[model samples]
Target: MWASSARIYAVALKEIKQLSRDRVTFAMIVMIPLVQLILFGYAINTDARHIPAGVVDYTQNQTSRALILAIEATQAVNFQHHYYSPQEATDAIIRGDIKAVLILPHDLERRIALRSNRLTQDSARLLNEPIGQWLVDGSDTLIAATVRSLRTMPLNDVTQSALPQTPVTFEVVQWFNPEQRSVVNIVPGLLAIILTMTMILFTSAAIVREREQGNMEFLINTPIRPFELMLGKITPYVFAGLIQVSIILLVGHLLFSVPIRGGLLSLFGAALLFIFASLTLGLVISTIAKTQLQAMQLTVFILLPSILLSGFMFPYQAMPEPAQWIAEGLPATHFIRMVRAIVLREADFLVLQQDALWLVAFTLLGILLASVRFKKKLS
Candidate 1:
């Protein structure tokens, strides 16, 4: 028993020494928890405030101006754009430029006057008619609920008019996923999360695996270039990603009734771009990581931000601007936006060309980085 205890101590000491030398693994150990703590404690917020919104004000009168200011004072929303028409506001929502739109009817003043005029026996229905309504993007349930809370709220302090006890200042009209089904949003976002996990994981360990399995020396002697080798690693996974997408989307549609409303070609095209981008990104990781364990650590480092900041588990708009900027760098963020737009809103492909171009540029840059890094490492 004494000898056994001594051997155990020997092995433990060696492992501690080895761990100290493995800087990447040690850094991951420290950084993972630190990053997670920072993200969860500070970056994530459920009670989203200052959400981006727009206004279509036909009144341009005191009531309208006061109403806008009153809503702004709530800090629930911040109106950044003043659209001329409701159609323009709808288009802006579709483009994801704003989350909700406050539409003030041209006769808002007259309606408020009717509400105040108890002297004449005006119809109760006219008095109760909502002063305005919200056109909300319900793809994000939290943001929808946030905006919905504004419905039936009394703004008498700002309106300076005698309002009903239950004044519906703004009725909310949820655009996509009107039923506010959580699954509708979750199903589409799953595609981004799943692909991001699989595509990157598969290739992040590509070159690392080769080195560990004793194939690196054999390949180094060959004529195959680093770019060609990286492409070879990515091509198979491209097909794998496609298959995964089909399964997720089909299963989502059949099981949850999550509609696939966009054109198949455009959807497929976006998926292809994201898959390539993710896979090449993995290749870059393969060159950076010295082992499979380290490769996986790096992938996890990526996924936390992807899950939190990509508007998957939480509302993207809810996060602080710094978090959003970090999220914008993740490939999953762009894919999630495209998938939701295509599947839920049925947004035209042209409307989403900007995100598509971003993915294209990301894919190209990833490929180049992976190739250059692999070449340098090989030399």
Candidate 2:
């Protein structure tokens, strides 16, 4: 019994020593939880605040200005632009410059006065009248909800105080997603997250695993160039990415009834570029990582920000400017924007040219970096 106990203790101590020596695994085990806790706790916000908003105050009266101030006071909207026309406000929303637009009707004051006077007899009629309009970029469900809640408060308060029993109404025109279905927004963005996570992990592990098993050394001695070798490794995963994309899209449509309102060809084209970018990014990570475990740790490090900062779970605009700048550099960010534009807004290739160009640039940059890193690591 003493001999068996000694052997068991020795094995346990040996395993602990091995774990200590594998610093990447040790660091990951210790740091991943801490990192996730900090990120999710501090960075992720479901209650959307300070949403960029444009106001088209046709009345331009004290009443309208006061109402705007009250809405801004709610801390939900940051009224940045005061446009002359509703067309300008709508254009801003479509351009992704603002999330919500408040249009004060020309007869807002007059209507309120008339409604308040007639409130005692026909309070229900007051609710039917369109006092103003709130044009929301409903593609983002959280922002829309926040804006809707905020916009109604001032109107509701004024109506209650003036009439004591009636409620005011505004036309909340949700531009892209009228129904405000969460699936319409989430399903498309999930494509970017899924592709980024799977492609990066697979390719990062592929190269590191080869190196770990001594196959990379054999390949290094072969006639294939480093760039070509990198391409060969990434090529197979592109098909795998496409397969995953198709499955997710099909499942999203069948299960969640998420609509693909845009052209399939354009979506596929953007997806192809994004997949190549993610795979090459993995190759770059692989070159830096000494082991599959290290590669995976680096992959998770990249993925967490991609999920958080890429506007996957939260509005990109809501994050601080520095975080937005970081998000702009991520392929997942551009991919999410492109996918949402395509799937929710039915945006065409012409409309999405800049996003496509960014994806192309990222893919090329990733390939270049991967090739350089692979050569340096090989030597």
Candidate 3:
């Protein structure tokens, strides 16, 4: 019996040693889940605030400005632009300059003073009224709710004994995501972050490790285009990422009970764009880095800002002006909005057209740049 036990112990020890020899296996056993848990916990916050907003005021009267001031008063939305036409405002949203557009119709001032004259009653009807057709990026319910809440403050009680004549009475109408549940806005963006950071990191180290082992030279000599090679490498990882998303969304749906308000096909399509964009960004990093360590360091640097500027942590509005500009530049910033619009608001393409376009542009630009830079590096 003693001899048998000793032999069994030796076999177990050898198996353990073999498992420990593979760094990936060891890390998977002891580190991956812990790190991911920390990430998921830290990243899954719901308090959305300070959304960037563009204003198009055909009613340039004091009442219009007052209404802008009213929306601004909540400190939830920053009025970043005052365009002459709604088209310009839409352009800003497409440029990723703002998360939503506030459009004041031609007689906005007159309509505010007396409820009878609304210029775009049809537009208002399309948005379900009172919100007056606010054109949001349609991504985040948190900001939508925040804006909605800010829009409908009680009218100044002129008869109140406290104060007889207040200088400004601002009336606001928030167009989308009226209830503003955190789950609605946060989940979609959360989906994007999970796909972006995890898929990129997983593939980043895979290629970098091959290079460290002297195998990537063979791959470099192949006739495959840089973009094609990168795409092939990321394809498997994207599939893995989709599985991860399925797990997360399942958890979100079953445990957290988050609803899927948007069309499933549209939501999945957006997710694919975000995944492609994130993977291309990782490929760009892999081209710049020589080792897995360097790739990891670079990924962390990118990940931090992606979380912060994407309006997942600080409200884009609450950040200082320069910070706001930087936040708008991040891809995650747009993804977060896309997720919110689809999951929380049940928004159609018209409401989200600008955001969808910008995301496509960003994805195409990233792939093109990565391919160019990667080819140059290899040559």
Which candidate wins on TM-score?
A: 1
For candidate 3, write residues 1-379 as lDDT tens digits: 9999999999999999977765544554566456446444544345545677888777676666766776676666778777888778766664456777777677653433343222365533333234244776544555555555554433342122243322322334333344444664566667766776786687778767777787767876777777787778888877777677678777888876677777877777777777777887888777777668767766766676677667775565555566657766777877777666666556555567677788788878877877787642333
Better of 1 and 3 by lDDT: 1
lDDT of 1 at 179: 91
Q: Give the TM-score of candidate 2.
A: 0.86
Q: Per-prediction TM-score, please?
A: 0.95, 0.86, 0.61
Number of backbone clashes in candidate 1 = 0
Kindly report which residue stretches of model 3 are placed more than 4 angstroms away from their true locations once superposed.
Answer: 1-181, 349-351, 375-379
Question: Sort by TM-score, best first: what order?
Answer: 1, 2, 3
lDDT of 1 by residue, 62-174 (tens): 77898788888889999999999999998888877899999999888777766655456663667667878899999889999999888865647555656454454667899
Alpha-carbon deviation at 363 in model 1, angstroms:
1.6
Which candidate wins on lDDT? 1
| lDDT tens digits by residue: candidate 2, 287-369 | 88888879989899889889998998998767767677888999999989888887777767667778789888887888888
145: Cα error in model 1, Å: 0.5
Candidate 1, residue 52: Cα displacement in angstroms equals 1.5
**Residue pairs that clash (backbone atoms under 3 angstroms), model 2:** none
The lDDT for every candidate, in the order shown, is 0.87, 0.82, 0.65
Give the clashing residue pairs of candidate 1, or none: none
Error of 1 at 19 (Å): 0.9
